[model samples]
Target: MAITSANQLELLQTAEAVAREKMIDPELVVEAMEESLARAAKSRYGSELDIRVSIDRKTGKATFTRVRTVVDEVENHFTELTVEEAKPFKEDAAVGDELIDEVPPVEMGRIAAQSAKQVILQKVREAERDRQFEEFQDRAGTIINGVVKREEYGNVIVDIGRGEGVLRRNEKIGRESYRPNDRIRCYIKDVRRETRGPQIFLSRTAPEFMAELFKMEVPEIYDGIIEIKAVARDPGSRAKIAVISYDSSIDPVGACVGMRGSRVQAVVNELQGEKIDIIPWNEDAPTFLVNALQPAEVTKVVLDEEAERIEVVVPDEQLSLAIGRRGQNVRLASQLTGLDIDILTEEEESARRQAEFAERTKIFMDTLDLDEFFAQLLVSEGFTSLEEVAYVEQDELLVIDGVDEATAQELQARARDYLDEQNKLALEKAKELGVEQSLIDFEGLTPQMLVALGEDGVKTLDDFATCADWELAGGWTTVNGERVKDDGVLESFDVSLEEAQNMVMTARLQLGWVTIEELEAKAAADAEAVAESIAEAEEAGA
Candidate 1:
């Protein structure tokens, strides 16, 4: 093919056709061609020369040029021309003016044509990937249906119309299998751009998959009359979904269940027979949790709001059902309600209550030197510790009809005395355990905590700084084959997690283990403030 005006029109037409086929902009193809042509021209025009090419969009004609800047002296002969040399290109050309030479188009050889083709293909591929990424990025978390195109090492690739999505082995529902060309529905877990192309990740076992299925089956949900609060799934086994209705007339659970369970059954069939329990959601967490534990009646619920934990007492016969097989029921309920749940039979709850009462009564009797009757009275009034007695207002303590002003004063005094005695003993024991005086005097460290640290061999600022918050505060673990919080330094010292964290941070600061720069910066700021105050004082005196 000759490098002529007529041939250039054919080239433009070819570029347009390729752009249309690749679903990319035609201008990108032309730009890629211009780059390729410029590279080829550089080969003939001394590779060091600044060569450029442009193809006219209207005329389909090519222009080749060498670009050189007019300068007082030519430091680089390839890119800069002296003003004297630049004068021939244009009489008015001055320093800094670009001197462009229009060179004739080159006849592209076989090698140049192959290079141009590669450049065009590379640009087209990049454009295609970007287009796919933009189209599907926001569609993540939505449901999508596709055909299984192929399976590679247990990862199924699905053709999602314009692009392909990967359904990894772990994302597939248990017992669910698909072959080539099999139709499949999935949730769009994520869409990410990679070096090769856009990767679309699909999931069949995500809890959101069930929620999306309900949206498809129930118009009430799609129209916003019913809303899905939360979803938890075991995938191909059982799942729990919490729903609520904005309209009082529309029953959220009934709408999700469909007529004779058709809607929920559709979702179940898609999940390969995963059982789903649609429960009504409530603003009250306890009510929501009770609803989440379906087919099992809850007799009583004790909530520890600070810990986000709930203990439920069920009838003796209903304990197994409430806990479910392998604790799946309580686990799903916890996930749905966003709380940790502990299931107990009525008898178990009573026994636990009696044990806690006796323990608290014994603590009051031993620590405050209170008689059994007085200790029982304090425990009944919800006074759990000597600290409460010592810190509680006299007016609050006076509300107990059996206690007079003198008696309340005596109780508070005795409580303070007991705490003081305990601290004094703790300090003595801490010294015996090799705890340093500096560590015992740390601002956030209580005397009792110092004793525990000493016993645990955390005898210095460095030792305390090395511990994580969980090491000081209690953490959950298996106790007697049941998962419960393990006693730690905080539990033994009766300190909160926040206080423990603060104590550890204080230790780190004291030891100069970290935050030295921060401490110095703060010190500088304080010094500057002090200097400003002194200047103001001097001015006032003057």
Candidate 2:
């Protein structure tokens, strides 16, 4: 079939119809049609010739032409023409002017028709995928309604209006099943273009799914009077939402719950009976944790800011309730508060308090050559270590019971004497073990740490670089008859995990260890190099 002037209207109508049906820009369809015609023209004009096609948007006219550049010297006969031969196409043509040769329409044979069809179909499909990707990309992290199209290996395929979204197996709620054609709501987790087409990933078990549901059900949240600070969900079981109010007049939790439990109840119903707890959000983590552990009363909360951990003491009767089945309650609370939580009964807390008191009292007695009575008095006054007593103001020590001016002076002197004696001993031992003075004088490293590392033959920065923070700090060590401290092998460096990792990272950075990103990039580069070497070897043998 030939594209004639009489049929140009029909061609434009066909392009417009396909554009409307596919929901793509009409211009894109016209461009695709032009591309298909160009492919057909290539068969008539040699494949090496620069044949082009364009359809006039207003006139619905298709123009096909061969493009040749006017050149000083003729090279390829199909692409370049000398200035002398180009005068017929353009009267005042220069050496750089592009000449166009108007070509009459030729009837497309069977093979050419088939080629045009494939070209049109491929271009239209690409345009559709691009349009779908753009439409859904902005909808990521939003809830969308769809019908279950099919199931493949536990993954549910949902038919959203404009495109298909895959609810991956791991993203589905536990124990939830969907039949074909069943209506479902899912969160649009991601929208991306891949080899086949645009892929929209959906999720039903995401914490964001529950948060979006609350935004839909609660007017205050939707209006921005209340904000969702965090969400933790155990899909199909229980979930917790932390909400805060910008307007002091409105209570965040109550606003989310609605009158007679109507607002939150709607969210709960949508989650397949997942129990929702609306807790008031607070800048204070302990207060937020107390509220998060609702239905069970908390007696006390001890926070370790350095460790990012909390210890919550509950009454013996409330222990099981605070922990929940399989420790889910505390786990969710931890997630909501962004702190590690350890739940303990009041009795357990008291025992731990006593144990700490004994440990502090022993440290003072051992370090300062103090009697049990004086050590116990110092511990009672909140003096945990000899360094605190040594560095504390004399006035502060005098405030303590039974600590007169002379007694305070004597205590400070003894504490300083003990520290100096210990430092001297550490220096002697370090010298004997060939420990570097630079490591010994490092700011964060203690004298004991240096001595320990020296004994272990980790004397230089390079030697220390080869060791993990746990190893440098010492994890399991023995002293005398019994364990002086069970926290660390060095008996003193009871570093938290964050501190340990920082110490290792610091050492590595100083010693030229690869960063996390650099490590990954290096691994990729090495893999590519190896693949190339193998390809070269294979080619050599071939």
Candidate 3:
């Protein structure tokens, strides 16, 4: 094949046709043709020569050139030349200047034409992938209508207009099967650029899919009058969605439910009859949790904010109802509220409370050498720990019935003496466990905390500094959709995460591992980043 005047126009025509068929930029196809032609030209000419090609977009003309750079010291003989040697190409050539000489187009042989065709095909495929990735990357977290193309090993391949989406078996609703050419709606879970092509992952079981379905059905949600706060689903079985209405006149739950249950029913049908409970969202977590556990009355809700756990007490009969089949109801409620919920009957809660009270009473009785009656009196007065009795104001103790000033003084003295003895024992134990003096001298760590750390093999200040905040103050980890508790070395001493971080940083500073300037600079950078985020948010709101 020769690049003659007759074939020059043919190159541009072929590029435009390929670009139109592939739905890519015509300029990209023309560039690919130029690159492929240049590769062929390099084969005909010296491979070491810097050959270049350009195609005129308007005239459909191809120009080939050999370029060499003028340099003070030439190392690459074919691509670089001295200023004197470049004088033949350009009379006033200087160092660092490029000299170009027009060259005739290559008369490509069978092997060369085949290689060029492969290059053009590879470039077009790459451009197609890039186009697909750019088109769908922004469509992630949205819903799309697609036709089922095929099923490959339990994965459904859908023809989603310009691209194919893979709906993994686990992402499909339970027992829901589709035939080829079946029309289906799915959520665009993700769009990823891979070696093969752009991968579009579709999901029918995602919680966001249900929320989006409601947005499509309910005008209020789409118009921003009502917002879906959270969603939790056990796909194809049951789901809970919490919504809040910005307009006071609009009832979020009623709006979502629609007249005669039309709106919610539409979403439920699309989800393969996944039952949905539309609950009104509340700022108070416990109140929101109460709404999440629908059709089951809650007598009381106790929340532990630090641990993100909640305890719900209900009527004895409602226990089974609140728990639902296989604890599904409580599990959904926990997911909706982002808390670990422990549901209990009223009887069970009462028994647990009685047991705690008895335990507290016994602790006071044994520690303070008080009789059962006196310990019960102390426990009834809201004193749960020896530290509370030891450090509480004398007036607080005097307020208790039948407790005079003398009795209060004696109680506080005994409490303080017991704490001092315990502290001494804890310190001695910590030293026996190989705890260094530097760790004992470190501020913010109590004797009991030191003993705990020593037992955990964190014997020196250096070891403590190396520990993570969660290692000192317990945290929760989500594994397989369940929150698991991670025990901390100083959790028993009520060490908060923030306090643990500060103590560790202080230890590092004392060891000169970090300077004050570095800390100040990091704080400034964080503040600047926060300020910038606020500014961006304000601009977006405007």
Candidate 4:
């Protein structure tokens, strides 16, 4: 049924063959051909014109129809068709639809045949590029094979099958060189197309470059006994891979190491002698955190779950090693774990615990009650004992974001309850750990001073600590309307002019109405009332 003369008939087979050799689908190639021909036609004529092509499955016969845009004033004859002229075949054709005209065999001369050939070839190339683009784009960070073409702009151009891929300067592994026509394998980073053609961008710098190489060398990785979850690299210098396995019987780290690290050694050699650390991936945050800070054993892990922070404590000897030079160890671990990791030495941990202890104690005195988050905050602060909190100073505790007056009071009460219980359990422990309880001295402001203020009541340390430090002397802390100078307490306490001015503002979280001056004025009024009562009593006695 098929004729021998059909180069026309064999056209479909030829197209399919081209697509196959390139690992491209025939249907896709056909689509690409159609798109390319359409593009070439529009470029030669105008975008206002349309071209359509059809291929016969039986004989490979192909045809092209020119479609013109309907317009009143036709400047471009190839595209714009006069409204009345396009009325026949253009019935349903709107402004956007094309008025297609069939070109006779005679109209397609030898030159036209040549032009058609160019269009088809150009289109086929573009389609091939697009197909390659779609195929390799998602394959970024994967290994692919290509031959070195030549160097340009200090970069290597690798011929990747259907496309010419570039290996940019920075993407080249350090000291790793290749010559023209040399067969090389690198990672496919990005794939795109330009006027030049399909670019199957290759890289030796991608983190997975090494992983892929290891996959080829290590059978276990190919067999799925080992899985690489993440990788980080200082390309050409050193690389680290985080791997895990499904079976508990299998050790990811050991498997990658091979019989004697030969498998991994081969990969390292391919990297031009780059150092590699094969650390075990872990699900336990603590265990994972410890492993992530490899080469240095972690003694403890303090985790702030809500904040996604982890503090890794190591022995004094391992501190420097764990943190690495200039904090590289912790920095890379943070990247690997995807967590903000803080590395601490034993001494640092101990000091931090003590400081945190002071913070909680202050919080207890100011605010009563401990929430889970606050407790975590306390832990992060480095507080290990309740006694330490009892004696904590305001300056130290104020640094924490959430430790307000109320929270401080709660912690103080809890610390008291805790101390009492401990005292009952071990008098010796109580003696050794002397209970520290200090009444918050509101400078010299008596309870009477607070009672004198109206609905504007004192509730927070800001209310009390609002006492300007510059006010060397203090009665009831006074605040001027906007400045601290006008507070009655300022004069009563004989505070410095600077201190009174500071109180007027209550800098951190200043109150507009009830400032230092307002509170000081009320304190003065209360003091005057007490004085008057004393005088009246004396006069009545006389």
Q: Residue 132 CA error for candidate 2 (Å)?
A: 1.1
Please provide, for model 3 over 1-542, each residue's C-alpha lDDT reduced to its tens digit, 9 standing for 90 to 100.
99888878888889999999999998998998899999999999989999999999887788999999999998999999998998987899998899989999889999999998999999999999999999999999999999999999999999999999999999999879999999999999999999999999999999999989999999999999999999999999999999999999999999999999999999988988888989999999999999999889999999999899999999999999899889989989988999989998999999998999999999999999999999999989899899999999999999988899999999999999999999999999999999999999998888998899998999999999999999999888889977789999998888899998899899999999999999999999999999999999999855
TM-score, cand. 2 vs. native: 0.83
**Tens digit per residue, CA lDDT, model 1, 313-356:** 99999988999999999989988887888888999889988999
Stretches off by above 4 angstroms in model 1 are: 71-75, 91-96, 364-378, 387-420, 427-542
Q: List the residue pairs that clash in candidate 3.
A: none
Query: What lDDT does each candidate get?
Result: 0.87, 0.85, 0.94, 0.67
Better of 2 and 3 by TM-score: 3
- The deviation in Å at residue 6 for candidate 4 is 12
Model 2, residue 322: what's the lDDT? 97
Of the pair 2 and 3, which is ahead by lDDT? 3
Best first by TM-score, ranked: 3, 2, 1, 4
> Against the true structure, whose TM-score is highest?
3
**Backbone clash count for every predicted candidate, in the order shown:** 0, 3, 0, 33
Deviation (Å) of 21 in candidate 1: 1.5
| lDDT, model 2 | 0.85
Per-prediction CA RMSD (Å): 8.7, 10.7, 2.6, 20.5
